[model samples]
Target: MSEAESELVQSITTPLRLEYQYTAGVASTRFLRGMADGKILGQRCPQCEKVYVPPRGSCARCGVATDLEVQVPGTGTITTFCVVRIPSDSLDIDPPFVAAHILLDGADIPFFALIQECHFDEVRMGMRVEAVWVDAEDLGPTFESIRYFRPIDEPDAPFESYKEHL
Candidate 1:
């Protein structure tokens, strides 16, 4: 074919869709159930005594089985964060919101959560925050059970408290 004809035929556009189902493992099942009951559950590593939220069933560092269940408080500290200025089609929130890594109390690993109900500029490392849960009747086995983390009235956590996690 001529180069002109090849260039004309090279471009195409189409809509694509996919669907799938997921089965949760024992650790995930237990964690999801705890979320449904308005609780933050973690598995304790017997070797190191470090608690992991969204338990992985085994210690990544110690390589030991983690069967002990520990309930961590919804309160946490913001170890790090960023201001999201870009808009997204999937989320209803406006631009310039804050997203942060929260070191939940009693858990060794930190997890990501959106920050709301406060000015984005006020967000800072070591800021104390707490989960804002959905209505009781709307609770389910999902992370959405907790809408987002918000700054609390308590003083910010000391740097020494969360420096290792960062």
Candidate 2:
């Protein structure tokens, strides 16, 4: 077919919609339950004695199933972050927010949390922050149970102290 003829042909179009049901595994269930209860949970690596937030289920490093549950505190240090200047309506939260990895207290590994209630420019690495939980009505067994993290009154962690975590 000539290029003009091919271009004149109507393009085949079909609307596609896909839905999925995600079943949280044992480790995730336990962690999400903790979030529902307004608590942060971590799994300890039996082999390495390292605590991982959200319960690694198995130690990624030592290749052993995690041992016990450790209660992580809401307050954490911002290990790293990215400031999104672009705006998108599909985002759960508004744009101009910082998406950060937080090193929660008592947990060796960090977890992702949105930084709200503060200016994007004010967010910094090693900044101390705390979780802001959703209301009781919206509470559930998911990360959404906690709204986001906000800056706390504590001083930023020293580079020397959190360098290893980075």
Candidate 3:
């Protein structure tokens, strides 16, 4: 390397940090408020009639505004999932837990959530589950209001019921 380049490579390094805040828009505000009330709110697409949990304010498929509110049950089916065995500083969960894509009943798009109260090996596609929310006193306008999903006594959903979504 050139003498100038060699000297530059030996320069001391310093740490850089950035902090920021995020503002939730109208649609997301509504969804978060619903969570605070112990409700799962979704929006239905006027054109396609598909529902979305934690509404995006618009339908991705039809590219139309989704303003009609729909309240879906806490029950859903596990569309896909993974068994996490790696640890990370950001997550409080221990390893060997299941993380799954859950398609809430009445919603077209699936959302990510933690699976608990069952063995990781037993989690599978189409398994019926239900959200377990924090107590009313602990409820807040955050996704954390629903601690995690757990297996319910309902039968597994048929592949045909959610194949189109996949």
The lDDT of each candidate is 0.95, 0.88, 0.95
Q: After superposition, how far is residue 1 of candidate 1 from its true place, in Å?
A: 16
- How do all models score by TM-score? 0.90, 0.86, 0.90
Q: Cα deviation of 110 in candidate 3 (Å)?
A: 0.5
Each prediction's total of clashing residue pairs, residues at least 3 apart in sequence or on different chains, is 0, 0, 0
- Output the lDDT of residue 56, model 3: 91
- Candidate 1 minimal-lDDT segment of 10 residues: 4-13
Model 3 lDDT tens row, 1-166? 9887777555677979898798899899999999999999999999989999989999998999999999999999999999999999899999999999999999899999999999999999999999999999999999999999999998899999998877
Give the CA lDDT, 0 to 100, for residue 63 in model 2: 92
Q: TM-score of predicted model 3?
A: 0.90
Q: For model 3, what is the error of residue 7's alpha carbon versus the real structure, in angstroms, after optimal superposition? A: 18
lDDT of 2 by residue, 23-64 (tens): 888898999988888888899998888898888599999999
Ranking by TM-score: 1, 3, 2
Could you tell me which 10 consecutive residues in candidate 3 have the lowest summed lDDT?
A: 4-13
Candidate 3 residue pairs that clash: none
